[model samples]
Target: MTIQTNICPRCGKPTEEGLCPQCRAADTKLLACEPRVTAVYCPVCDSQKRGKTWSDLRMPREDLIAELAVSAVSIHEDAKNLKVAVRSEDTASNRTACTVEVEGTLYSVPVSETCEVEILWQKEACDRCSRISGGYYEGIVQVRATDRKINAYEREVAASIAEQAEESLQQSGDRLSFISELEDSKDGVDITVGSQHLGQEIARMVTGALGGRYTTHPKLVGEKDGKALYRVTYSIRLPFYQKGDVVVSRGGYFEVREIDGRRLRVFDLQTGATRTLAETEVERLLGNVRDAESALVVFTQPNMVGLMDPKTYRTRELSAVPWTFPVEGQPIRVLRDEEQDRLVIVG
Candidate 1:
């Protein structure tokens, strides 16, 4: 068999293929170099911009460089049936680069080449971080009590729920959701949120977790784009009496067991019966269990149970409730009513 040869059109050289060896090499060299990849990053917050939203970095820097490098690679238009893969990627503090191996058929001939992708990381502040630095907030969440001051427990719960909500929202790709500041004051605990919707969400979460009500008040701050833009304020009000608190109402002392919606389930210290009080009727709080103490039972009679006060060491007889049948030497909680000069059974 004899090898067939053809003259290249441009180079006018005899070759076994369509183009001469020199022409093929020249054409292959015409393939453009890899374009520079750019990544907008917020160094302060460690966030990367994905499309229009700024998101926290989900992958390691090297892996991110590999992905971005592959995407930024531009194959020559003449090179059909192209395939490229990242062979290796290296990243530094402010820069990332990757080596990609490309293989494809160009003009009915197999062509292979390697390209370097350099990702220039531009350090800048994200939109949310910039606004936060400026003290910008679209809404405020004020945690308060319906009938009394906010307790330490309630404040902690509300703040924790708000923080968790922020994390949840951010992980869901909500770039605008952010908490600007959390302030504790004499009035109440205030949470400043970057977005109005986030503020509303935090208020709902606090109310839902702690069992309370919320009211939203929108104040017209200004107009934007021919529309009214109002800043919102969410007032989250907790119940007047939390569970395990001792309250005095209608000359009767009770220990709050549960706040079931519209009713308060309490252990009536006066009658030793579990009773329900309309939450609306809880006008004031007299005292709590902080002053109560456990007393040791000395003996029991038909109507009264004798007990020794741990503090005063004084022996006293108190009317026993039907619900409680104290055994000898059993300890029971009692509240001292100094005005009445008597000890009241609590629980």
Candidate 2:
């Protein structure tokens, strides 16, 4: 093959190919020098792929350490807080450990940032989030960070959790599911429950346990009887006409009383086997209450989140956070609206 030379882009030098010496030294030329590659194919095109690049400290090591030490004064801590340090004697080795404090509780973790404390990494701050209060429809803040890897990792985790929450809602027979995507984090995971009233490490633990999935969505589109319930689209298991019994529906359950006009009555499957509900009560029996399109379902048990009495198309007054951990026998939560382009999950 014959080699060709072209004018360098940054320098007035006649060089082989294109980029100049200055650009190469600026870490902008190509990874042919860095060894990092996003792809092994198409060498020239692949080398231009952007990746993370750490910055260097302009101050002396002593000053850098002192600055970090002083900055720690306002570090809001939690169960994962750590006391990090590298003594003067060990400065040569650049070793350190972590001591954390959260909610007045302390714990030690094995962590070391010794080697060369990347100034770029030190520039990062803890992540913060704000979520609405009450119910699963309320979105939440996970965390915030400047590092690309941390951001990517947090996004992936949030996606996994959101995906699970949606699935749980569907399986539980929710009317509709809608939601926004999750945020990133540099400190730790943050999440909100229905109404945004509660957010804590428990959310993180739940997210992790459920393979990073959970939601605060509620049952019944609106609030009733003081609490938000899950609204759903489901079948009403109806029974033969009856006199007096409780009816079940995809939305919730209700008791039947007296019949009115042209209407068919249904009976309860339980002890009130032959009892029939009134026409007005029949309407309640087949109630598929309006759902707020959240993942939270009203059910006494997690399983109940999916159950509805066919005999009366009625459901119990209950809702769930839709949590699941594959490592455990628990159910999984998948947010229905996480798909980009508003795509739906099938099979």
Q: Estimate each model's TM-score.
A: 0.66, 0.17
Lowest lDDT sum, 10 consecutive residues, model 1, at 25-34
C-alpha RMSD by candidate, in order = 7.1, 24.9
Best by TM-score: 1
Q: lDDT for each of the candidates?
A: 0.80, 0.32
Model 1 segments beyond 4 Å from truth? 1-33, 74-93, 102-112, 246-262, 267-275, 279-347
- lDDT, candidate 2, 1-347, per-residue tens: 22465776777577566665444434321111111112111121111111342122145655544444333333223223344443322222333222212122122322222222211121221111111111334434443322222333444555565556644553453313323334344554444333222232224443343222333433355666897755321111112322232345333233343333334343332223334334443333231112112222223453334323223334323233223212222222222222221211010
Model 1, 1-347: lDDT tens per residue?
A: 23565778888777776887567856665244566878888888889887777878578866777788888766777777777777554467766667788888776677888877788888889998999999888999999887678877778888898899899888887877899989988777999999987998999988776667889999998988999988899988887777667777787877887776678998887677788998666655646675578999999999999989877899999988877878888888777777677777765
Look at candidate 1 and tell me the lDDT of residue 10: 88
State in Å the error of residue 2, model 2: 99
